[model samples]
Target: MCPLFSNLFEIMIPKLDPTVIYEIVVIVFLACWFIATVLCQFRETKISWFIRYKIDLFNLIPLWTFFAPHPGKRDYHLLFRDKITETDYSEWQEMEITEERTFWSWLWNPEKRDKKILSDVVQSLVSSIPSFREKTGNLNLLMFSTPYIIVLHAVSQCKKRSQNCYRQFMLAESSGYQKETKPALILLSVFHQI
Candidate 1:
């Protein structure tokens, strides 16, 4: 009966090896680290303060390959007013006509495309306006414009989801400028949606 019990125990449970257990632990640790690093780099959700601070510290690692500073889509637009003509161009004509490439399209053909035409136009408008200079002291015009652009994007999305075209146009015009400028040129609002 004792021999039968011993035989059953040996068959049911293999001998445990310390070295094998150590190797498994190392493998599991590496896999977990890799996953954490990937999430830290590319997570869409806002990270907690502690995690962000830890990641910032981890960025000191010279060999670190994962870095996603501004992940996701970034859209920009130009809003200008011609004082001589007393006409406002709320939307950049070029941007209005240009079709946005989908994520799949971009992934399949990852070429250097001329995507910053709107941004360039916005910069030109800012530089041309003397009042803009006074209102924005040494701040890059892009930085000032980004929040407005994001808002416009949100409004456009809301419009699409709710099927409210009037609301879309309303938000486009009424969204205020980041800073009040003298009559030379107002940065106005970014037209993120076509």
Candidate 2:
């Protein structure tokens, strides 16, 4: 050891055996690991029970981040819909993902709301739609369908809205088309109101 290090160590722990330092470091590391594991396991149990019961109470607690890291992937989409001249229109809004960015960049950026909160809001909105409720039939189906429908509806709306002239022509050319597209028209109207 350097003279400086030896002098500092001797002053810090006078008359202590050098071997004791290694033992102390190991014990500290193991203790920290055990504590972290216990916290994570406890958090997981709470989260699993909350999800099983479909409880919104989980949001109020907000203890998940203290133990578990946020998920790696974010694949949720936000969708909006509206009807114009008896024709259906839809649009998808881009969602921001901060977790995927570099740690330094994330630290520098302003805080964003949790993705889970956005997902919960979308779930509530989608569940309120009559067609979605009828199609899903239960919580399990709703959970499975929510992401797919949000993405699908968003993409469909973008495609429909992009063809402004074509949409106008189609609407003007056929009164018959409106009858065939009544379900979409109703969905567009309902989602737009929300």
Considering summed lDDT, which 10 consecutive residues are worst modelled in model 1? 166-175
Best by lDDT: 2
Q: Write the per-residue lDDT of candidate 2 for residues 1-194, one digit (tens) a residue.
A: 99999999889875656678778889997886555444444445764554434543444323345424644222333334434446554333333332444577546744345545555544455545566567676333442455444544433444444344222101001122345533212122123221
Candidate 2: segments with Cα more than 4 A from true spot: 1-72, 88-104, 114-116, 119-194
Candidate 1 structure quality by residue, lDDT tens digits, 22-105 = 888999978866665555553334553334465656553222433335331323432222122225333322224134466788
The most accurate candidate by TM-score is: 2
Identify the runs in model 1 with alpha carbons over 4 angstroms from their true place. 1-14, 44-194
Q: Model 2 — which ten-residue stretch has the worst lDDT? A: 165-174
- TM-score, per-candidate, Cα-based: 0.25, 0.29
